[model samples]
Target: MEYITLNNGVKMPIVGTGTNTYGKVNNDYNGALTNEIPELESALELGYRSIDAAIMYRNEHLVGRVLAESTVPREELFITTKVPASEEYVSSKDATRAAIDNSLKNFQTDYLDLFLIHFPIENKEHLKNTWEVFEEYYEAGKLKAIGVSNFEKHHLDELKEFAKVKPAVNQIQINLKQPNKELLAICKEEGITPVAWGPMKAEDHQKEVLNEIGKAYNKTGAQVLLRYQIERGVVVIPKSHNPDNQRANLDLFDFELTTADVEKIENL
Candidate 1:
C-alpha cells in the first residue's frame, strides 16, 4: 500500500476501508455487523493498513473485536473515528470528550491515528469549540492528527480564525463528477490533505471515460477511478465487501495515467 504524508508528517495509507456500507442509521452491530467485520478482515489480509469508522456507524465494538483478535500489531494499523454532528454531542464539550473516550474504548486502542469532526455543524462557535477539544487531544498524544470532514471553504475559513492548530485534513465527497476543485484548492493553500470518500462511485458519463482509460492498463473502471484520484494527490477510502474488490482496490500503484487521459476524465 502507498502512503501520503499529512501536514504534521504522519504517513497515512493512501487507500483504506470505510465502515459506512452496512447502511447508516441502523444498530445491528451484533448480527449483520458480524458479516461486515470479515470485509475489514479481508482488507487487512489483503494488506490494507488503514480502517476508517465513526461513532454513528454503531459498529466500533465489532471493529474492536477484529483488532483484538488480529495478528497484526496495534502500531501497524491506523484506526480513525469521528464525533458526529448531532446536537447532543456537538453542543457540549464534556459530551464530546466522552465521545472520544467512547471511541477509544470501542476500538480497544489507546490512541487514534486520526480524529475528525464528522460534519460541520452550522454554528461556527460550536464547531470551533469542538475543534479546540480535538486540538487538546492532539497535543496530549491521544490523537496523532486532527482534521474535519464534510466542510466547505467558508466553514474552513471560519474555523481558521480561531484555530491555533490548522486542520491537517478535509475528508469530503470527491469523484469525477464532484472533483471539488475549489475546495481542494483551498485545502492545498491551507496545507490540508484532502481525503476522497466514495472515490469509485463515479457518475455514469464519467464511467465511460474511466472504462476507456482502464483498457490501457488492463485494469477495471473502479481501479482507473481510484488511480485518477491518487494521481491528483488525494487519499481514498473505497469500501467493498467482496474480497476480490477489496484486493483490486489496492492494485493502483502499478500503472500511471497520462496528462491527456487525466484531462479527458476531467472534461467528461
Candidate 2:
C-alpha cells in the first residue's frame, strides 16, 4: 500500500478499510453486533493495514479484538478511530480523556496511529476543550496525530483561531455524486490530507464511464473510482465483505490513470 505523509510527519496509508458496519448483523450500520468479524479477518489476510473506525459505530471492541488477535504485528498497522462530538465524549476534558483511554484499552495498544473528532463541535468552548484534550493526548504520545471529520470550511476556520497544531487530515465524503471540490481544495491549500469515506459510490452513468475507463486498465469501476481519488492525493477507505471485492480494492497499485481520463472522470 502507498502512504501519505501528514503535516506532522506521520505516514498514513492511502487506502484503508472502513469499519462503520463491520461486525454488525446483516452488514447494517444500525444492526445488532455479531460475535465475530470475518470480513476484518479477510481484510487482514488480504494485506489491508489501515483500519478506519469510529465510536459512533458501536463496535470498537470487536474490531479491536480482531486487530489485537491478528497475526499482523501492531507496528505494521495504521489504526484510526474517531471520538464523537456528543456530550458523553466532548462534554469535558476529563470525559474526553477517559474516552480515549478506554479506546486504547479496547484496542490493546499503547498508541493509535490517528484520532479525530467524528464531527464538528458547534459550541466553541466544547470544541476548544475537546481539541485541547486531543492535543494533550497527542503530546503524551498516545495519539500520533489528531484531526477532524465532516468539518466544513467554517468549522476549520473556527479551529484555527485557537489551534496550535493544524489538523493532519479531514475525512469527508468524496465521490462522483458528491465531489466536494471546494473543501478538497481547502484541504490541499492548508496541507491537510483528505480521506474519502464513500469512495466507491457513483451513479450508473458515472459507473459506465468508470467502467469504460477501467476496461483499458483491466480493472473494475469501483477500482477506477478508488484509483481516481488516490491518484489525486486523497486517501480512500472503501470496505466490502466479499473477499474478491476486498482483494480488488487493494489491487490499485498496478495502474495509473491518463491525464485525459482523469479529466473525463472529473467532468463526470
Instruction: Please name the candidate that would achieve the greatest lDDT relative to the true structure.
Output: 2
Question: Which segments of model 2 are wrong by more than 4 Å?
Answer: none
TM-scores of all candidate predictions against the true structure = 0.94, 0.99
What is the model-wide C-alpha lDDT for candidate 2? 0.95
- In order, the Cα lDDT scores of the candidates are 0.85, 0.95
Count clashing residue pairs per candidate: 0, 0
Candidate 1 local lDDT, 89-202, one digit each (tens): 778788789888898888888899999999987887688778888988999999999899999998888898899998888999898767788998889888999999878877
lDDT of 2 by residue, 117-157 (tens): 99999999999999999999999999999999999999999
Instruction: Please report how far candidate 2 places residue 261 from its true position, in Å.
Output: 0.6
Q: Give the TM-score comparing model 2 with the true structure, all chains together.
A: 0.99
Clashes of 2: 0
- How far is 114's C-alpha from truth in model 1 (Å)? 0.6
Candidate 1's C-alpha runs over 4 A off are 22-36
